[model samples]
Target: MRFQEDSIDSAGFVLRKDEVLTVILGGGKGTRLLPLTEKRSKPAVSFGGKYRLIDIPISNSLNSGFEKIFVLTQFNSYSLNRHIHRTYSTNSIHQKSFVEIIAAEQTVSSVNWFEGTADAVRKVLPYIREQKPKYVLILSGDQLYNMDLSDFIQNHLADSETEISVASNSVPEDRIYGLGIVQTGENGFIQEFIEKPQDISQVENCRQQDGSFLANMGIYIFNTKTLVDVLEDLSMTDFGKEILPKAIREKKVKSYVYNGYWEDIGTIRAFYEANLMLTDDIPKFNLYLEKTPFYTRPRSLPPTKINHAIVNQALISEGTILNHCEVHKSVIGVRQFIDHGTKIYNSIVMGLDHYGYFDRRSGKIPNGIGPNCEIRNTIVDKDCAIGADVKLLNLKNYTEYEDEYIKIRDGIIVVPRHTTVPDGYSI
Candidate 1:
C-alpha cells in the first residue's frame, strides 16, 4: 500500500510512527545458485533484470514506512553492502532511518562471526536494545515477493500479546520438508509448530479449516522486549530450529497468513525459472506496478536496443546493445554488449567478468568469421566471450560433454568463470 511516514496519523499500538526497525537477514551463501553465486553473496545476485534480489525486501520495507533499517551480512558482504547502500534507501528519516549494513562487528566479549540466524541477532541485540524500539521486524533477504508489510504490522498490533509473528504460506507436501509447519487453534492462535516435519503424513495433518497447510516464509516480526528477553535466556540462535519453534512451544508465536506471490529463489533451477518467468508480459511478479515498486540503484543509462535481431520473451536491462542475435526467454543484465550474428537462446548473459578470459586470450574478440552458432540452455556468466561460429547446445537429448568445460547441474549446462568452450565445438 506504500504507507509513507507523513501520510498516517497516530495509532499508538498500531505502530504508525517511525519507531519500528527492520533487520534484513542477508548473510546466506546462496549455495543453491551456484556459478552465479561463485563470488558474491546471495543478496547481491541480479534479479528482475534491473534489480538485485535483496531489493525486494528493502523496497518492501521502504514502502511500508519503516525507516530504521539494518542489513546483516556475513561472508563476501562487500558487494552486498555496496549494493544495499546504493539502492533502496530510507531518507529524510535521519541516521537510524537510512538503509545501512550491519555485519558481525567487534564486541567486548568476542569478534566471532555470526553463528546462526538467531545468533546473528543475539550478537547485535545490545545495539538493537539501545535503540529501544517497541518492535523489530526481521526478514530473510533471499525470498522473492512484493508484500504490504504494513498489513502484517497491523496484524501484530491486533494481537499485541503474541511475542512473535511469523509469515506463513500454503505449500505442497513435496516442499514442506524444507519449511516449518504450523497448526492453529480455534482462537486463531498457533497450537503446534513443526520444524520441517519428519513424516509425510504428519506434514499433511497441519491444515487450515479449508484443508491447506501453512509453511514458514522465513519472515518474522519480533516484540523488542520479548526478543531481548529470549536472547538472554538461550545459547542456541537459529530462528527455525531454535527461536521460533521454542517460542511456539511457550505459546508465544502466532502465524500471519501471507497470501501473496512468494517464491524461495535459492536453487539454480528455481533461480533460472524465476528469471525466465519475467519474460512474460503479465509475470507473477511485475516490477512496473506503480502501487508497490521495487527500488534499486538507478542506473543513469540509455534504454535497451535490439538492431538486426529477433528477440523473444526476454527482459533486457538498460545500456544493452544487441545486434543480429536471438535472445529467447532469458534475462540480459545491464551494460551487456552483443556482437553481430551471435545466437543466445534460453540463456542468461550477465556481467562482463565472464568475458574477461576471452578478452585476455584473443587480441580481439575474434571477429565473427561465420554465422549459425547456437548457444542454448547455458549461463554465460559476466564478461565471457564466444568465438565466431561457436556452438554450445544442450546435450541432454544429443549427448553429454566428454570433457570438463561445461558443468551439468539439474541437466542445465553452465559455462564456468573465465572459461572458453572453443570455437564451433559440439558436445
Candidate 2:
C-alpha cells in the first residue's frame, strides 16, 4: 500500500495504535562494542553526542503514535533504565501512554536470561498477551534510522492475508552477508528466506531489480496469534536464524521494503563509522528535522563557549568550552572542556557531566581534553580526563588492542568512560 502523502491521521487507515504494542529488543551483552558497552547496555550507549542509541527506535515508535512501549533489556541496564525514567514521563493527559522497562527476570516457568531475540519475546509472552494487542511491532534498540512506523502498520493491514510483515531494505551485494536475506515474488510476498548465506549464488538470487539484495532491517510486525503460536511450537533462539526462514514456508509473511537510510550499529567499526558519517556537510540521517525530530533527555545547560577555536565541519553540543583548539570533522559532546593547543581531527569527544576544577580539594586532575593533546581518529567516551601532552595516535598498524586507559579498534582509539590518561603518555 502506498502511504498517504497527506496527514497520516486523516488517511484511510485500517488500524489504530490502541490495538498494537511495541517491543524494543535491547539485546544481550554487546561484546563487539566492548569498552563502550562495558558500563552500560548496548541500547544505553551514548550516540550523536547527547542521545542514547535506543532513542532512535523509541523516537520512531513514539512519533508514529505508538506510545505504549516496553524496552526489553538484559545486560547492564541500570543506565538504560535511568535514562528512560528521566527522559520520558507520562502525565495525566496521556495517562494510557508509557515507556516501561521489562528487565529479564526469572519466573516460575523460566529461570534463564534472554537467550536470543525470539527467546526474549517468548519469555515476555505472558505480559504481552495480557494486553490483547492484535499486532506486535518488534524493533532493534541499537539501529540508527528514522522510520515512520505507521507505514509499516498500514502496509500490514492493507493485506489482510499477511500474518507477518518484515521490514527490509536493499543492501549492496557485497554487504548481504550477516543479514537475513529475503526473496520476494512479484506479488510482494516473501517466497524464501536465508540466514546470512555465504554463497554468492544465494545472494544473487535474492537481488532486487535495483541491483541490491533484500536484507532484513531486524524490524518486524507480527500478528499476535501468529507470534504466540510460533513461539509455543518451536524452541527457537533467534528470529533471523531460525524462526524467520521457517515462518516464510508455513505462514503468510510479506516484506515491507523501506528505501531509506538505515545502519545497524552492531560492531565497533560500524558504530565509529556511523558516528563519523554524521559530521558530513549534509548527513543522510538528519537529526535536526522538526517534523521527525529525534527525542532525548533535555538538559538546560548554558550555551557552548568557544575561545578562538578553529572548528570546521564539527558538531559541538551545548555547555562545551573550546579554548584555542583546532577540531576538524569531529563530534564534541555536551559539557566538554578542551584546553589550549589541542588539535583534534576526525574524532568524537564525549563531554563530561560536571565541571572539573584544578583545585586539590577535588583530588582528581580534571575532566575533558587537557592542553597540548594531539588526538586524531579517536573516540573519547564520557567523563574522561586527558592530561597535558598526551598523544592518542596509535602508531602501530594494528586493528585492535586493550590497554589500561584506552581501547583501539579499526585504527580508531576509544577512551572509555571515566578513564584518566596521565600526562606525557603517548599511545
Question: Each prediction's Cα lDDT score?
Answer: 0.73, 0.86
Worst 10 residues of 1 by lDDT: 351-360
- Which residue segments of model 2 deviate by more than 4 Å? 1-13, 91-93, 358-364
Q: Candidate 1, overall lDDT?
A: 0.73
- Candidate 2, residues 305-351, lDDT tens digits: the string is 99999999988999999999899999999999998999999898888
TM-score of each: 0.90, 0.95
How does model 2 fare in lDDT? 0.86
Model 2 TM-score relative to the real fold: 0.95
- Root mean square deviation (Cα) for candidate 2: 2.6
Q: What is the lDDT of residue 131 in candidate 2?
A: 81
Q: Looking at candidate 2, what is the lDDT of residue 387? A: 88
Among these predictions, the greatest lDDT belongs to 2
